[model samples]
Target: MNETRQPAHHRGRGPGRLIALVLALFVMLGLSGGTAFAAPDDAEKPPRAVWVPDSAKDLVAAMQPSWNLGNTLDAIPDEGSWGNGQTTKATFEKVAADGFRSVRIPVTWSDHQSATAPYTIDATYMARVKQIVDWALDSGLYVVLNVHHDSWMWVEKITSDHDNVMARFNSTWSQISTTFRDAPRTLVFEGINEPSFANATEAQKFQYLRELQTSFHRLVRTSGGMNANRLLSLTTPAGAPEPAFMNDLYTTIAGLNDSQLVAQVHFYSWYPFSVNVAGGTLYDAVAQKHLDDTFANIRTTFVARGIPVYIGEYGLLDYPNHFHPSRVERGEALKYYEHLNHTARATGVTTALWDPFSYLNRETLQWRDQALFDWIKSSWTTRSGTASFDKVFVPKSAPVTAKSLTLNLNGTSFRGVWQGGTKLVAGRDYTVSGTRLAFTANALTRLVGNRAYGVNATLQARFNSGLPWNIDIVTNDAPVLSNATGTSTAFAVPTQYRGNNLATMHATYADGTNAGPTDWTPYQEFNKAFSPDYASGAITLTPDFLASLREGVTATLVFHFYSGQTVTYKVTKSGTAVTGTLA
Candidate 1:
């Protein structure tokens, strides 16, 4: 979910070229003391080969099911300026109480530091970050403090500016290292988040990432105090999980001779399910295979070589306004979390969910989707190796009012139902058929007609029941559109009305011509597109759309929520533009 695309201007010669330039600059400057390029003191060095702590494996094991405080501290320009609410002490407490053992605090220091010489971070900003880190540590959570979203430093192509950028980068870390010099080992440092090499070839990008990591390792190690042997994390080239990228990273790291390193990579496999809404199901064979291949590669490339790996950020986009309309999307999102966490445990990788208040409400301290929260918790608690549930779809025109849906058990013996929600009835409304469940006629009718219906059942194992397992047989319903309003230059659909694919939307002119359901491309093709905010529940037409409207023309925008359910809002552009509520 933390896909930070490089800005267009950053593209140029790769890091290999920049390194040549950097070396030349170093020679020209002839200044060697206290810089990132400076060699470490031979006396302070641990050994020729880096000495990895015995606790490294234990640390990885403890950091299972980690959660990220994303989009909050890491917001560009300022914290909480982004849509996410300001993080409080209670935020970390809530996460830990809910069974998360680790937290990745992503913070951007670019705006908080001086752009000129020394590049000292503002004292107030540093203190605030320290307070948050202290809170996390106090809450008994492992904390990863990282240089996040520092696009100003990393996004630019290394050239004549390479020395200046590296100087600033080294200065920023020097300050950070000094500030947290005495902090406990639980406070891990991540060098960078999703470093981009916009101008580099694959080979160059890999080399550039290695250079960055090498510099980061050297700076942190030489910073003194606990940082000398701190458990540092580094990103793969572009933060990708590809075997080739990771293999290159592994090779580069081995040469670094540092054993106390954690390889951090982000996972958002299968874009159709992870980002777009066109995927069939989350637990389909294709999706599983993708995950399997990804983790397998990671395990083989990094984990097997005695290096710990962390999935610094991994999650599906489940914004209520955009992705929550389709039950398929919601179900798949939950399954993705479950499978990802389970796979993390199976392989020696720690997973951290990217929670920018998309699935959880930081303000109210409530889960936006309890089912997903429970599934994630169960995956961590039960450690169920392979868990899955049947996706129940009852047609509105079923012949019988009541029907029994069977749960498909994959060789594991079903123990018994642990918990069921209010939507399900144990005896009168439904009955169990071995591992299968039978819903009465009344229950079936309710599921068919209702907009939301589902029951979660926790099943036990006969033996070696890894974790208490739960499966949801959820009913799919047509998307609902409501509270739509519009104006001359803009039209608004309430967040609840929008669903996954805005591409399914079309505009019909009064003259019987139509436009879009536009393809997602350069983002400039269509002036008007749906932009929904899940937190605020506001869907408004962008200003670009209003400026592009033809004068003296009336058009009706039709949005297809599902196959048969379509909502339309009409707008007329006269001397002034006006609109009507969606119908």
Candidate 2:
């Protein structure tokens, strides 16, 4: 998901420096392979398709449970520059076998095209894109291809640089339409991804989008072959799901008078819950209501009007960083995914996960967490019961006691909790009363043998239907923090977690106003501002967070843990140096 402008913290040069270093190495080693493809005389007009095309609604419905090939062709300079590996035919095979019916391949053409009048896309890059699309098509998966990051990179300049933008846009699509003129109808053409405009009023933004989309429709229709009837998708400004954007997009498609057009929108849930900031640490009523209302509006605005809607991208904003602590709690995230899939089905919109090698391991072609993936996949067909929290945190220094958690049930009847193969005795080991599940002290003591500082045991809460909910038995203590000294660019608080997991961090000035990069909320974004490294026995304050601190002003930091413990500390940034002390 490319934003019009990245946040200051996200705009750091770490990735750019790495890309340059890697590209230089590739050149020095003479490993930059050939990109040229031998084109046949009739390459622009290949064999015609015999299969009849389905209506836009039917085609969109058939694309349920889709996936996105993100951060590949869309990667700024080249493929594999971002975390994900190069695209492979086996990747598509894996996607198909894993039950994804469609794939959205986002392509950024800026770096691969010329800056002159013709603005010809590099022949080699074009061929590579075609190869990947053909591979996905061979796997029997519907393909949605679009101009991706270029939307913000240069397309957004349409308002400021109209003629050049329009010329380049037309040339880019003309070449693309000609390249895939005879491709299968399964290969969809999306005009642009998350369209945006700079220095434009509401009227101008709407007018610009209508012009771009209409021009796209005209170019594709006149390009001949399957292009004449191919399914096309158009997104609102920034691909937001708000009503104004959706209404404008509807107006654009209706003006085109094309039944093969689908409305596209991207959803990352409510802002705070998406990134786990501003005290939105749970999937509460506000978050759930937002999902319900958004999907309901999409259905009413588009689907009911005979235009199918495609939730082009849907996932939490700060989801599943494989190398860092998850911003959102695992159980809470599970509930969000489960509810989202069910709601998507209820509203008749096809949804696609924005996977940039986070959900699936590109190197291993295996799910990073099979159990979590099971809940997501299962949610496509049925509901899953979840709990208020996944972990039962027990203080290692205190005597074991009864602990209770509220069960969501989610329309399922809760059966008893089980430890591996054996089912615990209901009344003695645990008790369930009207959505409340409590574990006896004896059961907890047995589970947390030796009071290990981490997860000691895992139990499954079974339900009459859907996947079982997992409960982790954890033994923990209030984390210990020590004073440290370092520069603002590099600083980590020495911490002894003992067992508890970090939840959120609160920052404030002496006058009680919020501090850090996001001053609007005292609760800074997890991973963005601070991250917990349990193995390293410390919590690292990100350079972005440290730099955002007000100079010569002491900011009090209150670290909150999942065990309901808060550790207070103070930090003062002076020049390039920073000092930390226990408060």
Which candidate leads in lDDT? 2
Q: After the best TM-score superposition of candidate 2, give how far the Cα of residue 318 lies from its true spot, in angstroms.
A: 3.9
lDDT of 1 by residue, 155-205 (tens): 445534677777877788888999988776767999888887666788877
Residue 424 of model 1 has an lDDT of: 43
Worst window of 10 by summed lDDT in candidate 1: 1-10
Considering summed lDDT, which 10 consecutive residues are worst modelled in model 2? 4-13
Q: 1-583 in candidate 2: lDDT tens per residue?
A: 2231111111112333453455446557866431111112222222111122357887787677899998999998898889787888789878766777789999999999998889999999999999998877755567899999999999999988999999999999999999999887778899999988998887888999999999999999999998998999998888999999889888888888998999999999989999989877889999999999999899988999999988999888858888778999888899999999999988888999998778888999999989888888888778888898899999988899999999998899888899999899999999989999999999999999988899999999999988989999999999999999999899999999988889899999989998889889999999889999888999999999999999999999999998889999999999999999999
Regions of candidate 1 where Cα sits further than 4 Å from its true position: 1-53, 83-87, 152-155, 278-283, 318-328, 363-370, 383-583
TM-score of each: 0.69, 0.89
Residue pairs in steric clash, candidate 2? none
> Best by TM-score, which number?
2
Q: What TM-score does model 1 achieve against the real structure?
A: 0.69
Candidates in order have lDDT scores of 0.63, 0.86
